[model samples]
Structures are given as C-alpha cells and as structure tokens.
Target: MTKDTIIQFHNVRFCYDEVCAINNVNFNILENSLTAIIGPNGGGKSTIFKILSGLLKPDDGHFSLRKGSTIGYVSQFTDFDLSFPITVLEMVLSGTICKKVKPFYRYKKSHRDKARNAIKRVGLEMYEDRGINQLSGGELKRAVIARALASDANIIVLDEPDSSLDVEAAADLYRILINLKSDKTILIASHHLDEVIDIADSVLYVKSTVTKFSSTEEVKEKLGGGIII
Candidate 1:
C-alpha cells in the first residue's frame, strides 16, 4: 500500500482450457516508472496484457489498479485492414472517449488539440490527416501509440511495440518512450531485452510465472550468460 504503488497482482493465475497461462503471479508496479516484461512468445505475455487491459478475466486470483487510476493499452498487433478507411487523426481522437464525455456529442476543440499533441509526440504530425491505410508498418505502430497518448490515462501499456520495425524505426520508438518515461507510468512487454534494459527502471522476466522482478542491474545479473524465458 505504498503511496506510489499503482498496481498489484495477488497470486494471479489464468488458464486457457486446461493449460496454465500464468501461475501464482504476484508483483507491484510503481507510479511514474517504466517496467519491461520480457519473455518468449506464447509464454503468456499477451494473456497478461489482456488481463491488465480488461480484455480478459483471470480464472483465479486478482489484479488491482489503484483507486481512480486509468490505463491506455496498445497491443502488439498491427494486422489492420488497410482498406478500411480511417484517418490517423480520427483514429487517435477515438481515445478521447476515455474522458467520459457525453455520448453522441461532437468532440470539442480541446479533444482535437490533445490528439494532435499526441500525434506530434509520435512524430506523425505530418501524417495526421492521411488515411491510416497509407502508413507503413512502423508508422502504424506509432499511430497506435498516439491513440494511447490521447487517452490521457495515467498508466500506459504497450505490448511488443518493436515487433517488426526496422532498426531505425525501432530506435525512434525507443526515443519516444524515453521522453514519455518522465511523466506517464508505462508497462511494456518486449523481447528486445538488450535494447530496453538501459531505458527500463525495472524488469519483469516472465515464463508462465514471474521469474524475476527487480531493478535493471539486478535482473541483468540474474540473467547473465544467456537470455531465455
């Protein structure tokens, strides 16, 4: 119950049919810090994100967000149907719904302004008015990030944001994350341990369970000589 603790998982467990996706997971996420959850694919990373984002309910145990806390999540998926017409700005503006404004009401200027700021933060200001179909893979990833940012949530979750980007695009993504760490509390599930270790204040290495949770230095030492989930 520390003042800065924003999230906690108490003996959290999830089962898919008969297979255990997560077992006895327990951890606390502090406010205003970046946490990297690193593990192999199919190791339940997406399952955990789904649970946190309220897309799924764990079969057992509990995960709690501090009172009044709100979260914005962008998944690792980018399999968008490009032909589905939607502009980048419009997509980002969708995040404004989190504000709980009246339904069917036209978005105010403030909403558009905030969405634009988020677009600029992701370096997509020039493409704001363009159809999402026009964006490259990397650009699409950043656009999703902008959508999350526009939500104005105190906590943000990003799952494998660097999955298919080229080295330069991935580097740019990291830069935006670095700038964001100063304000928003961020949780990321990434396999790029070497790249994220430097920026992450803490790390959670999971393999159907939490294998390690500690400062970056300590976790690196614990994982020395090899990287495996």
Candidate 2:
C-alpha cells in the first residue's frame, strides 16, 4: 500500500542573516514513517527541522505540510530549565496550550486525559506528579517526549533525543520511538546515526542540501561512516 505524503520540501532555502543554512533542498516525508536526519555539526539539519516545526520560514522555495497537519516538537532536555519547579504532568499539559483558541484558555478534562495517556505512552506514568528536576536523564527525555505526544500532533519532530543518554538509555529511547512510528510521522535529527539507523524507515542526509536514503546500507555508503560526525 502506498502511504500518504505528510510533508514536502520543494527546492527550499533558508539563510541566517547572510549565511545560508540550506539551499535548494527537497524531500518528502511519508505518513507513519520515522526519518532520521544526520550530518556534520554545522550542517543544515537544524534548519530543516526548524522549518518543519514552524519555528522558521523558508527564505525561498516551497515547504508544505498536508492540510491541517500539526507538528509536535521534542527538543533536547538540556534545552529545558530544570531548576524550575514543574511537575511532569504540568510540563506535558503545557503542550496542549498551543491549540487553545480562547483568550483565556483553559484545559478541559479531555486535555488532561490526553496528557495522562501521553505520559503513559512514554512510560513516565509513575513520575507524572514528580517534579521535573527529580527525574534521571533517561526519564527526563521520556518526559519531554510525553509533552510532545500530549499535543496530539500528527508529526513529531525531535532534535537529538539521545544526546546525553548512556548506551542503554539510548537503546530504550529507540524502542519508544519505534513504537511511536506505528502512529505518528517522526523526524529526528541526530549526530548519532548508528543508534537510529536500524529503527528509522528512511534517512535524510543534510549538508547545504538534502538526500533521502531507503536503507542503512545506502546511508552508510553515502555518509562514509555508520556514525555521522
């Protein structure tokens, strides 16, 4: 069966001030597929994701998502302010605030249910009421993922989800991501390609341009090493 295309980038280009991040980039992401974007440190992987997450506009060309599609972003936990006294449930609940239409928006019972379910999905149910600062590295990562899932987004974009994780924790994260792909279209940008290569349905190698690979072999052949620097 042919899957529906979730996102399409047609000769997209973006520049930060005078520096071009991505130029003439093109790719399409299919529904219910997990795609890993890998590249060098200064490559345009971050640009591609920023565009996808609606955090930035393309300076040129076309970047489109399926009509009415929403994106949920899971940034690295390190990007969060851990010192803040916020519970896991509260963190996840904030994800739903973006969809609020009223000037004085309030979360409904259904929203809380979704947040609870999202926490369960990431296996963080036990820590739902725990303060975010109290969680370990792996648990914090899962909490952030749960926050994204709580938004009921059709596409999930994660930036270096395994950045600070140990080997076992990284493996655990991959498992959670694989399970997520059964329902959500997932995009992850990681320098640790080997960790995600086996689980990803496809790979997007981004430099100033983008190329899609269907298999790990092709990615290995193109990237030169199984792990991207």
Candidate 3:
C-alpha cells in the first residue's frame, strides 16, 4: 500500500544571522512511518526541526505540512526544571494548554482523562504521581513523550530522545517508539544512527541539505566507508 505524503520540503533554505543553516533541502515524509534524521554536529538537523515546528521561517523555497496537521515536538534538551514541584500527571496535563478555551486557568474533565490515558500509553501509569526528579532517566523520557501524546498530536518529532540513556534504556525507548509508529508519524533526529537505523522506515541524511535513503546500507554505501550518523 502507498502512504500519503504528510510533509514536503522543496528547495527549502533557512538562515540565522547571515549564516546558512540548511540550503536546498527537499524531502517527502510519508504518513504513519518512522523517519530518522541523522547527521554530524552543526549539520542543520536542528534547523530543519525548527522549521518543521514553526519556530523559524524559511528564508527561501517552500515547506508544507498536510492541512490541519498538528506537530508535537520534543526538544533535545528539555527546559523543564525537574527540581520544581511537578508530578508526571500534572506535566502531561499541561500539554493540553493549547486546547483550553478562554479563562484557561482550570482544566475540564476531558483533559484529565486524556492526560491519564497518555501516561498509560507510555507505560508510566504507576509513576503518574511521582515527582519528575524522582524518576529514572528512561522513566522521565517516557513522561515527556506522554505529554506530547496528551496533546492529541498525530505527528511526533523528537530530537535526541535517546541521549543520556544507557544501552538497555535506549533499546527500550526504541521499543516504545516502534509501538507508536503504527498510529503516528514519527521523526527523530540523532547524531548516532546505530540505535534508530534498524527501526526507521527511511533515513534522512542532512548536512546543509537533505537526501532520503531507503536503508542504512544505502547510506553507508553512498558514503563509501564506515557508517557515520
């Protein structure tokens, strides 16, 4: 079966203070598939993400998402203060802030149900009441993912989600992502491809530009040497 194109970038170019971050970038992302964005440091992966997340506008060319689509973005480094007094459930509930009507100081019953369901989906049902700081690294990452889910996003974009996780935890994280791939379009940016290459349906190699490869083997062969994310 052929999947619909959920996102498209045609000769897209983005810059920051006269410094070109990504140029002549073009790619099509299929719906309900997992795409891994892999590249070296300072290679414009972050810039591409910013553009997709509506944080930055392209200086030239065109970028488009399917109409009525919503994006849920998880940054490489979360700015949330873990030390703050916030429970996992509360954090997930915050994801629905954008959906609240006027006088948004209070949340409706539907919002709480969504948050609780999201936590369960991520396998954090038991930790819903735990303080963010008290959870392990893997557990905390799951909480963040739950927050994205609670927002009712069909497209989920994650940046270095496996960062700082141990080998076992990283493997587990990929398992969770693979499970979610059936219902959501998943995009992940990582400096290392070893973790995601096997699970990703396609690979986007970005280095001041973008190219789509069907598999890791194709990317490695094109480079003509060892695999380098």
RMSD to the hidden true structure, all candidates = 1.9, 1.9, 2.1
How well does candidate 3 match the true structure in TM-score terms?
0.93
Best by TM-score: 2
Q: Write the per-residue lDDT of candidate 3 for residues 1-229, one digit (tens) a residue.
A: 1249998999999888988989999999999999999888888988998899898999999888888778888887567677999999999999887654666378789999999999998899999999999999888888898999899888999988888898888888899999999899999997657668778999998899998998778866775434665
Instruction: Say what the RMSD of model 3 is.
Output: 2.1
For residue 86, give model 1's deviation from the true position in Å. Answer: 0.8
Off by over 4 Å in 3: 1-3, 99-101, 224-228
> Weakest 10 consecutive residues, lDDT, candidate 1?
220-229
Q: What local lDDT score does residue 93 receive in model 1, on the 0 to 100 scale?
A: 95
Candidate 1 per-residue lDDT, tens place, 1-229, comes to 5899998988999998999989999889999888888887778788888899899898899999989888889886755677978999999998886446667878789999999999999999999999988998889989999999999988889999988788899899888888888888888888778787778888887789986556777877778524644
| Candidate 2 regions with alpha-carbon error over 4 angstroms | 1-3, 98-101
- Rank by TM-score, descending? 2, 3, 1
Task: List, residue by residue over 100-202, the lDDT tens digit for candidate 2.
Answer: 4778788889889999999999998899999988998988988888888988898999888888789988888889999998899999988787877778889
Q: After superposition, how far is residue 109 of candidate 3 from its true place, in Å?
A: 1.7
